[model samples]
Target: MPIAFTVTYAVFAFILGSVIGSFLNVVILRTPEKMSIVTEPSHCFSCGHRLAWYDMFPIFSYIFLRGRCRYCGEKFSPRYMVVELITAVIYCLSYLVFAVFQPADWWKIAFSAVMFPVLIVLSMIDIDRFEIPYWCSAVMAVLGIAAIFVFPSEIVWYERLIAMGVILVLFAVLVLIGGMGGGDMQLMIGASLLLGYRVFAGLLIGILFGAIYGSIKKLRDSKAEKQLTEQIRDIAEQWYKNQLDRGVGYVADERSDVIVGSISDGAPDIEWEFLDEKVWVGLPDKSELSRMLRQNITDEREGGFKIFISGADVKKVKYSRRMVFGPFLAVGIAVSWFVGAQIVDWYTNLF
Candidate 1:
C-alpha cells in the first residue's frame, strides 16, 4: 500500500476507535447499573446538564472542557479521556498490524474488533463493580468457537478444549485457595478457549501484574486495615452482645472454633451450616454496623471478617480487603492477544 493511503487508513482507524471509545464510556458507566445505554441521553452526573455535541467529541472534548462539566464546572474523571485515547491507539495499532503490515488479515482484524471492546468494558466494569458480567465471557467463548472453524490450521478444536479444561481446573484451585475470584476465573475460562495454550502466558502475565499491584495495595492499606479491624471488633462485639441480650444466638466461646464468614452487600453471611443447628437462634442483623463494615472494605468480593472468641465473648476481629484483579488480567490478555504466539515461539526456541 502507498504510504499516503496507509497513513490515511491509520488515521481513519484512530478516529473510528475514538468514536467507539465514546460509546464504550457509556457502556462502562451504564452496564453495571443496568441502565439503558442508548435510551439515556448523555448528561453530567454532577449537574445533570445535557452534554452538547461539541462537549462529547471523544478525546478532544475532555481536553477542551478542561475535564469539567461546562454548565456546573464539576470535574469529570480523567478516565473518560484515557479510555478514548487507549481505544484510538489500539485501533490504529490493529490497522497497522492486520491491514497495513499483515495485509488482508480480516480474521485478525475481526477478532481484535470484538476482543478489544469486551476487554475494555469488562475491565472497567470489574474495576467499578468488582464483578465481570457473564455476557462478556459468553461473547469471548462464542468467538473462540468461531475461531476453531476459522483457524483450524492454526489451532485445533481439541487444543482449545484442553486449554479450557486446564484453565478451569487451575482457576478452580485458585478460587478454592481464595487467591482469585469467580469472575476472574470465568473471564479466563473463555479466554483459554480463545487463546489455547497461549492463555497460560496470559495467566502468568496477569498474575505477575496482579501480584505487583496487590503488594502495593497491601502496603498502602495496612494501617487502614488495622484500624478497620478494630472497628469491626467493636461492631461484632456489640452486635453479638445485643443478640445475647435479646435471648437470641448461641454463645461462641473459646472452645467454639474461630467463626469465619464473609459480608455480602453489607450483610453478614456467616457459615451457619457447620454450626450446631439446635443452638442457632436467628439470622444476623444487617444493621448499621454491617453497612459501615461494607463501606470501609474496598474489595467486597473477597472481604471477610474472622471472629476470634474467648471466654464466651468476641475477642478480636480480623478483616482482609483485597485489590481488584480484573484490570491487570485484562491487560495481560490484551498483551497476549498481540504477542503471545511470538512469546511462546521464542520460549520454545530457547529450550
Candidate 2:
C-alpha cells in the first residue's frame, strides 16, 4: 500500500496497456475486412508503406512523426493516438484505484485490464462495421462463466441465471421493436451472466448515453439530409428528365423513376444484417437509366414506358441508414465491470 509501490505498478500497467492498444489498432483495422491480423504487416492505407519499428511505438511514434506516415507523409487519423492514450490512462487508473488500494486485490484489476482491449475492439469494430463479431460476445460470456467458478461473487447463482434469461428476453423484445440490434442483445446476455442484477445499471447507463447520442445524431442526419437531399434531388430530376426524353414518362404516383427487372417491391427489404440484399449492378443514375430505358423499348405501343423501382431500394439510398448501439453498450459493460457492485451497494444504501 506504499505510495511508491502504487506508482510503480501504475507505470507498468500503462506500458502494458499501450502495447495491447497497439495490437488492438491492427485488430480494429483488419477484423472487419476479414484480413489476417497477425500475418499481415502493418502498412499505410494510402501509400502502402510498411511501418518501421521506430514508427510503431504506439503514442510516441504518432507524436514524433507528427501524426503522419514516416515514408509517405500521409497524415494519420488522431484516433490512433486517442486509442493508445485512453487505454494507457484506463489501465493506470485501474491499477491505482483497484489494485494499489488493496495489494491482494490484483485479480479484480487484472480482469478489468484484460476487458479494456475487448471493449475497445468491440466499440471500434462496431463503429467501422455495424456488426459486432460473435466471437467477442462469446469471449465475454466465457469470462463470465469462468468468474462464476473461480471467484466468489455476492450475487447468487440463480440470480445470475435469472438475470441472463431476463436480459435475453427483454432485449429480444427490444430487437423486435427496432429499439436494439441482435448484437446488443448478445452482449447484454453475456454482461448479465457476468454482472447479475447489476447489469441493469449498465443498461440504464448505456440507454442514457445512447438516447442523448441518438438525439444528436438524429438532428445532425436530418440537417445533413435536408442539404444533401436537394443536391441528390437535382440529380434525380435530371435523370428523370433524361428518361422522359427516351419515351419513359412519369407514372401517376411512383416512388422512383429507374427500376430493374429482378428486384421486387413486395418482398422483405432489409435482411437481418441490416443490408439491402441487392447486387448493385449500377446506380439508378441518369446515363444508366437512359440505357436501360432504350433497351426496354419493346413495348412502345403501350404509350410511354415507365420504370418503377422498388420503394425499399429508394428508401435505402435516400432515407435509411442503420444506427449503431454496440459502442454505447460496450461503454456500459466497462462501467459495470468496474463499479457495478459499488453502484448496487450505493443504491441499496439510498433506500
Candidate 3:
C-alpha cells in the first residue's frame, strides 16, 4: 500500500474511534444505572443542559471547553477525554497492525475494532461498579463464534472450544476460592474462544497486572480496612448480645463464624441459609442490623465482611474487597490481540 493511502486510512480510523468513544461515554455512564443509552440527549449531569453539536466533538471539544460544562461551568471528568484519546489511538494501531502490516490478516481489523470498544466500556464500568456487564461478554462470545468461520485457518474450531472449556473450569475454581468473580470467568470464557491457546497468555498478563495493583491497593486500603474491621466488631458484639438476650441464637462452641453478605442499594445481600438452624433458637430479622451496618460502611465497591469468634470474644473481623479485574483483563486482551502469537511461540521455544 502507498504511504499516502496508509496514512489516510489511519487518520480515518482515529476519527471513527473518537466518534465511537464519544458514544461509549454515554454507555459507561448509563448502563450501570439502568438508563437508556439511546433517546437520551447529551446533557450536563450537573445542570441538565443539553449539549450542542459543537460541544460534543469527542477529544477536541473536551480540550476546547477546558473540561467544563458550557451551561453550568461544572468541571467534567478527565476520563471523557482520556477514553476518547485511548480509543482513537487503539483504533489507529489496530489498522496499522492488522490491515497495513499484515494485510492477509485483515479480518483481525474487524475483530479488534469491535473487541476494543467493548473492552473499554466493560473496563470503565467495572471500575465504577465493580461488575462487568454480561452483554459485553456476550458480544465477545459472538465475535468468537464469527471468527471460527471467518478465520478458520488461524486456529481450529475444536481448539477454540477446548480453550473455552478449560477456561470455564479454571475460572470456576478461582471464583469458588474467592480469587475471582463470575463476570471475570465469563469474560475469559468468551476470550478463550477468540484467541484459542493465546487466551492463557492474556489471562497471565491480566493476573500479573491485577496482582500488582492488588498489592498496592491492599497497602493503601489497609487503614480503611482496619477502621471497617473495628466498626464491624462493634456491630457484631451488639448484635450478638441482642440475639443472646432474645434467646434467638448463640455462637456454637466449636463454630463461631460471622458472615455478612453482599450489600447493595436496597436489601442486605446476606445469605440467611448459611446460618445453622441447630445453633439458633430462632432467626431474627436482620434488616435493622443490616441497615446499621450499611451506614457504617461507605465504599461503593461490592464486598462482604467476615467475623471470627472464640467463646463470646470477637477474635477478628476481615473485610474482603478486591479491585476490579476487568480493566486489567482488558489490557491483557488488547495486548494479546497484538502480539499473542509471538508470545505463545516464545514460551513454547523455552521448552
Q: Per-residue lDDT for 1-351 in model 2, tens only?
A: 678886787788898888888888988888877899899888898899888878999899999999999888999999988888888888887877676554557676767777778878888877766768888888788777766765655577788889899998889888987757788888888888788888988888898899999888878667654543443344445555554455444322334333322111212121123222252222334346444434433322111111233433232224323567898988888788778888988999998
Screening candidate 2 with a backbone cut-off below 3 angstroms (N, C-alpha, C), the clashing residue pairs are: none
lDDT of 3 by residue, 229-274 (tens): 7877798778767776776756666655555466444233566666
* lDDT (0 to 1) per candidate: 0.80, 0.69, 0.83
Whole-structure CA lDDT of model 2: 0.69
In order, how many clashes per candidate?
Answer: 0, 0, 0
lDDT of 1 by residue, 1-351 (tens): 789998998999999999999999999998878899998799998999899989999999999899999999999999999999988999988888878766578898889988898999998988776788998888888888888888887778899899999999998898988758898988998888888888888989999999998998889878877876787787678767776787665454434435566755445556644454443445444354455455555444445667775544787778877567888888888888888888899889997
Which pairs of residues have clashing backbones in candidate 1? none
Who is ahead in lDDT, 1 or 2? 1
Please identify model 2 stretches exceeding 4 Å from their true place.
225-320
Candidate 3 lowest-lDDT run of ten: 259-268
Return the TM-score for candidate 3, rounded to 2 decimals.
0.94
Question: By TM-score, who's the top model here?
Answer: 3
- Sorting all predicted structures by TM-score, with the top scorer first, yields 3, 1, 2
| Candidate 3 accuracy as lDDT | 0.83
